[model samples]
Target: MAIDDAISFKKLEVFLAFMKLNNMARVSELLGVSTVSVHRSLHSLEEAMRCPLFKREGRSLIPLQAAYTFAEFAQRAVEECEHGILKVRETAGFNAKRLKIGSLYSLTLRCIPQLMIGLKLRKPVLDIDLTLGSNRDLLQQLADGKLDAIVIGVHTKSEFHDALDPELLSIPLFDDDIFLAAPLNSPYSGQTQINLTDLHQEKFVTLADGFVTSQDFWYCFEKAGFSPNISMRVQDIFSLINLVSGGIGYSLLPGRVAKFSSQIELIPLESNYGAQQRITLLLPKIRERDPNLLALTAECRMYGRHDGKKDGFL
Candidate 1:
């Protein structure tokens, strides 16, 4: 016989709860509904199935043998539906136990670690897979669905802003000033601030073309109206930092990297050539409600709120 229109997955859930609890009040409590609602659900489920699944004794419902037999099929149906839903979500890269995060290598010094710790506290079971790359690379990966979320720096006047997808959501975390990275014993180290024009003739080691720092590097120099004497270009921020620390050359870097190495000092740039790297958390808008992304965004918001009170550029 065909099932009645009253039969639904929700009603089956209520029926299963009633079959297991056997007490309408307890079922109501378990399902967070009124006892009357639970009783009505069971009665409707019985009517829909055209079966006396329960024998009513006053206000209590005693499961008949048919109820027990049917429960096996109902439980299987529920379990299979749940599994199917999980599979669909997994395929869509939603509600997965693993969270794929992309970030700039520079953020690993403090920002990424702090965010990860807080995220772990919120979702202990979530496995975070981190991929570090330049801003351009990370953004591309995120757009291609290779990464679920990314933490990257975007300059105020940058073309990177235009590269952002309309479908992506951006959460601003904090702004980090671009600084002239100098070795500890460099001639400019003791200065309060350095003008970009003064660094026009200075040899510099910069990250390659795709990094946000590289863009900032070029932009500042363009403002200075002269090309820097680029001594070397590296693929990663750490390498650029090492090159600068080892006295290879000066580089324009984010102030956040100040704490990454003791041998390197970040000197403020002249205002005319200064730029602020806006550290932002970006995720697909479609998955904004995903639990892992929600946790990450919460941590990012907390970080942004408490950012100014912190001493260093974090």
Candidate 2:
């Protein structure tokens, strides 16, 4: 009612259509409103704009120049709004049809398989489409809406960082230690926990740059005060452990990976090892309410993990 108040877009829309049709009765029918209501909106819009939109012309409504000018701009604005609504609906439909999930390549080798098997038996209806990448790339994909969730390793103090934003949720599911992986017959094999001094002269097979697990490995060395001599650098966890099996070099890695092969042995660090490696389930912080993501997060927590040295590899 006040001149300073914002003009209602709905009123402007009704006015624009009335100006085009020049017949209140026809506009009312087309717009699914009573003629009286259409006339009220147009009159209100004209008053709001502080200008006359239509002039009385012998038995017919004649649009003023201002009304014609406003119609062109209003049509484009309404069209854009309608397009946005359509795009949002299409995006929603795609999300409902597929669960775009990502996992760290390291986890994709083992932990994710267990998750998939566990998830399918519980949710056959979930049309899972998995992407394998680094945790950084996976998180970026989640923020961009290309992925609904990610499963990745959580290093110490790494879980609560920017990776898990307020708009995203995460829960620790399992942990693996940065075990001192060595050949089954190595001199350090019989030792339950390998001391920092034991590795001082050993060769190391480590992950390449940009891997999260790599952070735990190198930082542990830094904590121990000496970087192990590098013998080989690989991008995948499975390969690094395999090279260890071949006696190529010794390396530090999560214990769960060692389960996939029997040729290698894991020596727990004299310091806490499992305390360094943790696995977490992550998903975007969306408000639209997704029952599927919530259920998947629950499944991750339910799958149990083996405690360190449980298989006599102490």
Candidate 3:
């Protein structure tokens, strides 16, 4: 007879428990069954194995030599089955050892890479999956449980308070000042400070509507008391920077993006339009204590603290 068809793993579990505990009442309590049920299960296991598993001695069940040998196989089989299940879960991403992080495409230039380096130093064996997209997309994925955590830019304020979902937790990473990215040869590029109104007649390239920087890009023109003649809208910040480099148009972005290219000049704007944007780490409040997330969060916080004092915004 085939073992799978003849023997029940459940009955074997009871047999194992009884063999170790040596008490029908204790085995039943441990398995959440009655003494009668435990006795029946042990008998069933013995019948399936085609061997006597126990010998009775003064109302007590004593294991036979056969019982010890069978138990060794049974324990190994049970443990292997459990390990198989865990492996399947990990492959399906249900229970995973890898950490999933989400962020804006821009941060991959600096902040994201730095954080990953710091995280690896502390958790050498930890694997990380970094997903980059718009702030809107990242936040939605985080809410749907598709991402472990997110790093994105928030509106900066002196008080450093961020308005977010109550179920989410955020840690401020760093503050980055907003600047205008212009073609290296543009007249504005030579200026130490470019007034927003100076770009009234200039066409601009920008990220699409869903991006946080896109909104902030427009808001600068609005605050400057004029509307930008938007020439093109793209999906990624790097592409937008490339467009500016080709003299396609000027664009507004956070200071962190300035390091990505030498073809464009990152010019500071006047106070009326110059505002610092806050970079923050966002994760579900429920998972705040998860070991990987906690370690990543700590590394991010430390990176921000140290980098802010040096180059500013890691």
Candidate 4:
């Protein structure tokens, strides 16, 4: 016979409790419901099944052979449903103990570490796996579900670049200005502002093409109507900084990296060629409500509010 709409998983649960305890008051106490509610659920279950599964006797329920048989199936159904829920959650990375995060290598100097510490405080048991790469690589990994979240830089004026995926959600952390990175002893180091066109003859070091800084480098130079004399291209920001600091060449970098090394000087670019990098946190919209991601988002927002005032990175 087909089951009635009143035969729900909740009713099955109440039925199982009643079968186990054999007393209405006990089942009510265990399920945190009124005894009257428990009795109503059991009555509904019997009506839906079109079979009497219990023998009622003065505020007590006595199980018959049919009740015991039905209880076995009910328990299995509940267990299987619970297992399915667990598998679904695991597939979605929901409530997982580990959080896999991706980020730009440049942010490791300041932004990433501070966020990590705050995230740990908020979720003490959560294990964080960090992957550092260029902005393009990180964004791709996040889109593919290889990483849970990412911290990267994007153009401030056009926050959503053409390459950015619309399916992802972004949180603005802070706005950082791009500067001309030069060796401490360079002649232009004494200048407060340097025009990009004037540096056309100067050899420069830069991060590889996939990095946001590399895009910024090309954009500023293109606006200046001259391509830079690039002497070296590196994959990571730290290496590019080392090359610029060692008098190898000049490069364009964000102001947040200013505290990384005193050997390099950051000079503002001419207003017409100036660019700003907005450091942002991105996550998949599908997993935005996950507990771990929620905590991480909160930490990022807190950091964005205080990091500017505390570190003067903005």
Candidate 5:
């Protein structure tokens, strides 16, 4: 059979399943078919590709190098198909304009809401589905096609340049300064300057692991040459502020969050430990030309441009 005629969607699906599970029985179980059916599909796929995808050894079938490479393409193809199906269904049955977005929980306060509103004004019929999580989670969702774009904080240093996936396209939004949050009545609240070492004995509150703030909080301790005495770990920035307001423990946060509460005081660090966090909009390069995503990118850039000019960061 010619390559075009031999390859079927089900065959590719079975090929991907075999690559992942590496067991005919398991692939069959996952595909809701008999093992014999899965075996036939695998044979059909290998023949269509005209390449050795596996090496049989005893009762085990070890995948060849080409199999790994093919699996990557297969996964992408499957995801794109699913994406197309979803778009079609949303347009046909729902008759509702839809765009899926993910963001760091912190941006919900100012950045995300503004972007969504801007997009809505440009496309009044558009409906946005927003998912809020940590930087890592949002990025994962974007790469998985669960989100069209993500707003997150990237370190302005090495991490900004090196940590992201090469295939992801990013747009820098603004620069935010990191600050320490303390109770309004705390002694540190009245201080002209404070070092992390000065608060060595004082308990601290922190965002739980996986958040960008959590990493920055630890980075401060590393810079101050001491370990933080963390008293609590919360899921969101608001909760961290509430804890500080109630005299639970002091915490470090980006400047944007300081406006959320007047009960807490923000203290600027005296040393170079006050690193700037870069707020960024990230999307998959593959979806760069998507119409809905293009509109979103335009709004984000327009907002960034205007905000940057207003703030003198452009």
Candidate 6:
């Protein structure tokens, strides 16, 4: 007598046929002639309500009042079942795959680009997204899960060493010795090598804040007993090297990047000038065994040299 008394649409169809024909044999013949099946459908309809829907009268089955109520909404229940299936299919297609990596602006220009190309050549389907940031910023992003990894300077006593996990891995990629880059033909270039103390009065064009090299540059100068004569601050190494080529102001840079200009003299500092800096590939110790990272680390090692042959800077 309520909405819960609804019956299946298939059962409702059998009741409709019985009502229209008034004879089980005639209903079965009109609906494909299975008299036994027609009887079973009516039996199930009665059991569902704990009451008989029809009784034999002169050999013809008759429908009860409950049958009329049950048939009224059977079609709506079938429609609701169909709609629920469509909603689930709509939600299954939205997630896409991609990997995000972060790196210093310096490496992004050269090292990372080369390595990514190599990686692409080998694995073209890998979806890679590279983010450029200052070394410190990239390191922070890596810790926060915004990046999978980063490439930057490695220092044993650096603030990061304390923060990295126990298995923190470091690979000596190349020697990134800080050099005094001066105009190639400048009077200062003729010297076989320069001592850090002698350059105390030289003008310095330093990297703007947030760079790992900027920190190391100042640290080295202080170690040599002089404060840098910072004449200007620049955001990118390529631009800074171009400025150096014009002889605007001398700057400090890693040996590999010093290759930016054939006109710039890269003067390797003497020991008293400062400690030698090691350019390392840093990653979680756990990833050390990952073939892809390991392979790329090897790629770095392959291109990592600054042959004194280029300009005899050493």
The C-alpha lDDT values of all candidates are 0.86, 0.73, 0.83, 0.86, 0.81, 0.67
TM-score for candidate 3, residues paired by index: 0.69
Q: Write the per-residue lDDT of candidate 5 for residues 236-279, one digit (tens) a residue.
A: 88888999999999898887876677899888876667667788
Backbone clash numbers for all candidates listed: 0, 1, 1, 0, 0, 0
What residue runs in model 1 are displaced by over 4 Å at the alpha carbon?
1-82, 307-314
Model 6 residue 118 lDDT score: 69
- Per-candidate Cα RMSD to the true structure, in Å, reads 4.4, 8.0, 7.3, 3.4, 15.2, 14.4
Per-residue CA lDDT of candidate 1, range 154-228, in tens? Answer: 887647577678898999888888889999989886887788887667898998998888988898888889988
Q: What is the TM-score of each candidate against the true structure?
A: 0.74, 0.66, 0.69, 0.82, 0.68, 0.59
Could you tell me how far off, in angstroms, the CA of residue 181 lies in candidate 2 after the best superposition?
0.6
Better of 3 and 4 by TM-score: 4
lDDT (tens digit, per residue) of candidate 3 on 3-33:
7454778887988998799999999889899
lDDT (tens digit, per residue) of candidate 2 on 200-263: 8878888887667777778778778787899999877778878989999988777667666889
Segments in model 6 whose C-alpha atoms lie over 4 Å from true places:
1-97, 108-110, 156-167, 285-314
**Residue-level lDDT for 213 in candidate 2:** 72
TM-score of 2: 0.66
Better of 2 and 5 by TM-score: 5
Pairwise lDDT winner, candidates 1 and 3: 1
lDDT of 4 by residue, 1-314 (tens): 66689999999999988777777789889999999999899998998888888787776677889989999999999999999998898887887989999988778877899999999999999999999998878878887888999998888765446556778888988888889999987989689789888877889888888888898888888899988887889998788889988999999998878888888989999899988888889998888899999999999999999884444344
- Colliding pairs, model 6: none
